[model samples]
Target: MTGAASISRLVKKSFLGAYLEDALTLFEAGSFLAVIHQPDAYALAGTAGPAAHEDLLQRFADGVIPAPHTRELAVEGVVFGWLVLDTPSHAEASALDFVARSLREIISRELLRRGLGAETLEQYREVALLQRAVGKLNGSLDVYQVAHSLLDECMATSFPADHALVLFLDDASRTYRIVQSAGSRELPYAERIAQSRLFSEVLANACWDDADGEDTLASERMVKGEIVNDLTRDPRWDVDVPEVSRMLIVPLATSRIIHGALVMASGPSSRPFGSGHLKQTTTLATVTGIAMANAHHFHQVQRILMSLIQSIATAIDSRDTLTSGHSQRVARIAHSLARAVSQDRREFPDFAFTEMELQEIFYAGLLHDVGKIGVREEVLTKATRLHPRKLELIGMRLELWGAMHQREWTDLFERLQAINSAYDVSEEDEALLYRLANKSIAIGEATIEVLSADELSEFLTPRGNLNAEEWEEIKRHPAESHRILENIPFTSHFPRILQIIVQHHERLDGSGYPAGLEGDELLLQSRILAVADVYDSLRRDRHYKKALSQEMALAILEQEGRLNKLDARVVRVLTGALESVEHAEAPEPRAFGLGSPVDHP
Candidate 1:
């Protein structure tokens, strides 16, 4: 049979029954039939039964065809066995030859049918396994989880690897770094390679590089549908374990770039892998490359999102010079506090935060005052007694008033000249100006007094320079922030982010703005953000007041906790944590450390 003939499409089991029927017709009065071959071998088709089977088998046992009564079964001039006959008159010699030939066709057809069935079953099984592996790979977006899982599942497929290792490309270094390894527990050298920084060196020696010239066809040979069956006899191969007689190395790559390489090795006891193993492993390598690419892309997108969050925080803080780093400080403080709470697992047993949840808390703290963007710039940056422009206008008006009065009162003129030249005014001039400072000063003085009254009202108001109307405008920020974020697409990835952003200003007591969500109604993230915002604000210099000392800030936080405006346990934990950190040298702010491009195995 040709190679194509080995792949028979005849799967119907009825073919076996038809084959037996055709075989029976080849005999006239055959009493027995005997077919013998290698002992204990499994065959697809065989027959042994009845008087026909017994007497024909006895004739063959006598070591001859028994010419007139028996015929030999031969194919291509080689004896397969014999089909013996026992007839009243021996069948014609020509008829016996035809029978033997016909029986050969039937047996061949049966063998072909069985071979195809087994092949089809194996194909189905492999397909099922591949589907399961692909499903597991697609289930997670985490880089390391997907990498480890893919390596494990690929090992279980068609070829059982004795030892396997997956290397991911470190793009910056232009070298493969082992990211995952398996089945190397008993192999010291392999384990050492997996754990060492020079893992690439050991694996590179076993695998051929693509740079080998096409003239040698080395690349073609490596990619051929068969395992690279030869091993280079390097001194590094002196590992004293079972020798890896066969190895398979396939590139994990798409059309774009070579992402990494997959290396699988089998020891002496394993049957040598062939074309079939190489083909299956090549497919697995392709799937793994796609998965790694996707994971890398996912992490890249997360980094971009984190940068966007920080940028937004920086923008909000930039609106006021005094608050340049306010948002960042709050975010850092909130992150520290959350971590402290998480560490105290005994008191807060259910406390937990996935990376994403922690990110949300930090973002909420950074954006707590995002609504200030909507507040009037005047209100947002309002500082001392008067806006600088209003103060300057008042000063100009006072000078003009003094100049106009200088002409009418000679003594006042002399006083003004003395004030301008010698920085002194006569006693009479000072007394006269004091007596008339409020009632006697004319239009310019009256106008200045009116402006001054407003300034005094603002400066003496205790905290912040906002009037009732301006304070109301400032209060609208939280709601304005909610309105602004509502139109954003944050809900698509994290639906809870918007609610956390809106509730950052909320207090445990019913005193906080937007909505007076009190007590248990508040989310833990929101409470953490609120506490962080208050603490950072207290220790940060603002237009309204000087910055409080760390001790004073902690005291105020404690007082707020006692008043039920903040969680007391959180306050205590955060304060203690801050105290411990204050004495140590703090690191300067830098970009978030997502992770290194290449992880150690």
Candidate 2:
């Protein structure tokens, strides 16, 4: 009765079934290998024999196989599988049946040897599937599916669990409840167990303090046991442990936050699971925990990016006093318009973005004017209608004229004092001198405007007025703004934003300067920014120009959009947002935030 025969084309099944069929066959050594259609699948399961059984049994008894490994049957969700060797009565057996049992022991031990080998392969396959699922868990929506599927696969194929249930720890309920379930009818009790002291203490409350796996699991059994804990502690639990008996619970956490716990269990058919069984189930629970943590981390990454963009916007305010906070206002208005467009059925019926995309857009809007940082303060905050050197030039001429008159005035003062003790220029005389000086300064400035730099230098050398050399300095601010933006960090990652900032002043009719890109050549963001920049500049408070009312600003934008320089859709979005903003700001008798407006469809 050799048991090494092979068969062709065998279908795979629960980890144990395939092993039993493979190890029970008998045949010629080499010929047996080819008998099975898929012999290779179970080729690793060893042949049956008494010696083989004894070897594995000794390995398990001495703890070489380990408690968790010894009870691996429970881990795979197999309700029960007794390792009946030819001879064994320690746990309890009849003395008269010992010899017959010994013969069976040899066969059973050989079966276990075969089964353990097959289990090793099956376990590795299960883990491989889990690793693959982990690699694919990049999106939030897929997380729930992958996690549930991982557990189900392990149960249905490995342990043949008719049902699988996952319970997430609900802090609010102070208990555990089924987040996902697909097994038995009594799964809802998982929620009821949330308030159980044993569950709260071992799995949720204090499992972390214990270092030993056995101690932690033993504590869980007290909470999860059907006869011992459930019968006495949970009167609500059905008298029979039909739905749940052996359970595996593992803590779920990452380096940053402890999200919750994962709970896996087998019903009444699978109670008193050994240590190895508990360990395997806990490992599966850990994988689910990591998937949840990854989703959390993705959101954190989004927050960090948003904060960096806001910091850049703040930098602009600190650098220029007159134009401080210009970028922030743009972000608000642009975001408002973006929301209007995003929510508008006419524009984007199904267009939706994660909060993170909107955050990214907001940062782009705020840093739109960061390039202005490179513009000189004199250029950015030009005090007068003209340039800085304009005023300085006047003072220089006035001083020189006073110097020339000093010598003659000194001689005249001495002579005048000799004739009269106290006589000075009369009010009329002083007024006449001041008038002549200002009149001469005006003539110099006007003439300086028409003169070339070289020609003006000749005039300044003679101590006459040329012109304020500052207006030219102020006009170059746009170029300075471009240079400043060229050096911005993360430009490659956000080039569209950089382009919009630099080309904001460009018009659609090729009337704008710099690159002279016209029409569709400009990005959508640039077109939107162009319209927004113009409107904001006209409506917002500025030192260089009077603030135009919203009505007037809208009129100007309407003309621009009509001419096709700026996008028409953007104009519509802006119009909607502006109205929304006004309504939001209008202290409607009882409102504190934007009013909810639902769509008919």
Candidate 3:
């Protein structure tokens, strides 16, 4: 077959046929087309003689392709091999040279497409990581928790470092203070590294400095909104470090305000951070700033809610004169006892009140007597057996009976005297006078008995003169309180607050109401409230009796504990707390937080 027609037919049968045909159209003497195997370079298929193909493959494998070589064939962005001319220097070779250049353009396009695909995938991965970090940052309401989580996320996302310092800018101090840190578990120096004066100075300088040209990228990121990856070269970082060490400083800031900065450092022999690390660190800082802002707002809302609750408690207390300031005193006592118990867990085993649980107890104490609002004013104010009005009615009935019998008693007295003879009388007359006098006395005594029945019954009663039915109504107040509280929605923060309140009056022996929950059934907080409530009640006068001295009240509490009417552990703790309160001066009321002393008033 002639060279052109033979080649055309061969191209039609092979996979390379289409490429070869189009390539040969530009030249009379057909050029060789083949695929190159990389690394161990060799031509898979070719139209040239074996000698020429071997020479081309050797040159490609040696990393040296001759000048004026045929076009490189690429598939899927990989250099496959060359499409070479069979007859070089011929007039057609010149035309075919252009063909090689066109093939090269096609390969270049494929390489560019592959590169773009890789970049797209990398971007997607970064976005996913960023979203995950942001989620972690916004998850907590506490400032320290947000800061710790921010540092954790940064380290998790490829910013490997042996040590890190998280500083928050105190607007009042106008300086950054280290709030949290992570890593460096083994070295004692590492533990104190973040607290070191040198470290503090560096961070402080970085935070306060403006974006002057002399400032290093580390400090300027705060002002210029950039990132610093190399602490070694940054003039802003004044610390002396080993040649192998590196650091990254990212500003914790948003568009509105700058919160702080995160300083991350890798020790000697550790890998240094690069541009990609700096980008992710910057993203983490941004997320952290948002989280901090959200946390601050969250705390503000919490403070407002606390104030609202306190107001409600105060309003509830104001409903009755007898219970004035009762709720506040009970809450303070409850808080103090709880703190005492927490400090000595060994003494009070199987009872550990977490921070949230303690808060629930405090709130429960403040609202424990809220149920009294449902009680009638007369019932609440009843200070004696038989209300005064009832006693007055009894007194009026007695006076009417006395007036009606007055004439009868006078006539009897006259008849008796007539029997005794108008003046000095005989023995019989005298005896008759004595008998009539005795009869009159008996009659008067009988009448008096009849009139005093209601008064005597009430006066003889030990507690308040509420009849059985009236007392039962008073007993239902706790349940009413529970019902009222149930209507108000509570969040997960106080899961068992209502339960504690409702069950506060329940005794260990099941003698107390409303549900009569006994030992082990009642919560620790319920027992605590019960003790605090009873202690305060005894310390203050009620409608039934005068207030008991603190020592007497404590003794009664101890008696109840012995009788199984109250929690013994709670009683003991509370007694100690009361003693402490009696001796110690009143302290300033402190906001609730760990390590703060309990408020006594």
Candidate 4:
């Protein structure tokens, strides 16, 4: 039954029945009172009425009932039923007319109450749907992720579209492309629609050229969202997806700028899109647009920050010509090694790096040598045990000594040159240097030792060119890097960047400098960086050592692994990765950025 008819029956049974019976009592016996509903012709007979309910309905249907006092029952200009009374005199008829007016007023109030209740329920449903859309969109900061979430929301129960597509604007291209889609329809049709002039005009808030040559401002439709009930008949519908019978178009925008458009379509068998669908989709688009805007701004800031970081790394590497591009190579190698480790689950059962963690590792590798900026250039570039000027002064002193003593000291000068340039000084050479240290020379009334204490200490060095003080300064770089990075704020996003960079030089054994961190005290990211740093350092030539071949470099890394100075699993992974690339049919592996060897030695 219709709601109005049902309300009419309920009022008669609950209140009108008793009033009609009392009104009949005010008249003589055999008085009749009945209510005939308009929708179903249902009759309710009063207790004092002589006619039965079914007979009254039959009489009304047959049009054979006697004419009686009649009052129309209606509410808000909509007729529900009629109240009929048959009495003996004018007094009883007048009293029945008063009763009929009172009954009409009661029915009207009940109908109004029912209408308000339904309106309130619909409002509650709409609020709940909006809350759910906001929750889903707020879960991620990635723009693509937000787009996917938006499509999912459109296909949800509240919106119920057969197909949905989210198109985002590419600022550089000045066109829109579908980023996310749903349902069985192929993407070519939607893609064409996204790039069409209709979507462009909608997003740009410009005039749309109708198929009949009429101009319609698309922005007007976009203000509250648009619904095209029949795509075949709509003048603006150009792209043909056979299954789509109707569609809703809403712009994904905020007050500042429009980012894209959201298009939802229904198939031939599904319900057509309506004004309610347009309202819900529009609200969803607004929430998604705000999320996308925030994500875009965040990524822009991230790009700027990354550019600044790369510039700093370049400056650090440029200080010494031999170490040029060293930081970038280390970063690439470290990132590759981390990826390898993550794939080898058996070896590192508890270790796996997420994409964010891998990025942190790469950044750490780039800034690993940032502390070198604080070191003096002369000390950093030192390649010999003795300074050139010191050697020259010694040569002049020896020449003076030869002239004063009337003897040639050419053999001693030559021996000094050999000792200064040799990679390793033999016992015989050390004894010769000791004897030279004890000798003295007098020139212009000034007596000076043949080798000063500092000079003697530097010349007798057993390995590499750096002296004791210079080596100490070089070792302080990692700590200096830590101090410099400590001043910057990177803890929020890259929480472990400082930890990874400071510990890159550390070893599994306690032989590393600075903190002397060992074994479990180190992070897996730090271990990956350490292996990369050593591998690159071995492959590239420095002032003290010649560049090693790839085979030789891997062998040295393996040896370090065996000695417990590096992570054996990580070293093995790097070895396997390099070997796999070599045997494969792809182009020669350039991922590590390995360049031709330089012969510094």
**Candidate with maximal TM-score:** 4
The sequence of per-residue lDDT tens digits that candidate 2 reaches over residues 191-290 is 6544545445444342333475333333433222111212334544333333665545545544433445555556556545455444455545545555
lDDT of 2 at 260: 50
Q: Ten residues in a row with the worst lDDT in model 1?
A: 1-10
Overlapping backbone residue pairs in candidate 3 total 2
Q: Predict model 2's lDDT versus the native.
A: 0.46
**Candidates' C-alpha lDDT:** 0.58, 0.46, 0.60, 0.72
If both were scored by lDDT, which would come out higher, candidate 3 or candidate 4? Answer: 4
lDDT of 4 by residue, 1-601 (tens): 2225544444646456677777777666766777667545555533347754446666666765555556666667666676766555543557667776777677767666544444533443354455456557767978789899888777666565778888887899977888889875664566777644555555555235366776544555443467777767766666666667777778887545677889887776777777788778877886787677674533333233334555566666766667877988888888877877888877787878886677677778877987886689888777778988999888887787778788778999899988887778899999988987887887679888878889999998897778988888989998888876664435454788888988888899978878898999988898889998999889987876789999999999999999999999989988888754223331111111112211111
- Candidate 4, clashing residue pairs? none
> Please, what are the lDDT tens digits per residue for candidate 3 over residues 1-601?
0011111211222535456566665654444544343333243443533245556666655646544554555444445455655444444556656765665565566456445545543553354455466557778868799888987776565566776767777899766777887765422333333343444544454354346854344434352233334555656555444431566666676544667777777765677677777777766776677677765543333333333455556555655546767878777777667767776566686667787667777878776776776677777766655665654554454445446666334444344324322222446644544443233213454633322444443443434446555677778877876765563334566778889888888999999998878999998788888888888889886766678998899899999999999998888887766776434332233232222333422
Candidate 3 wrongly placed segments (more than 4 Å): 1-306, 345-347, 399-461, 581-601
Mark the regions of model 2 whose C-alpha exceeds 4 Å error after superposition.
1-306, 343-357, 387-495, 562-565, 581-601
Worst 10 residues of 3 by lDDT: 1-10
Select the stronger candidate by TM-score from 2 and 3.
3
User: lDDT order of candidates, best first?
Assistant: 4, 3, 1, 2
Error of 2 at 266 (Å): 77
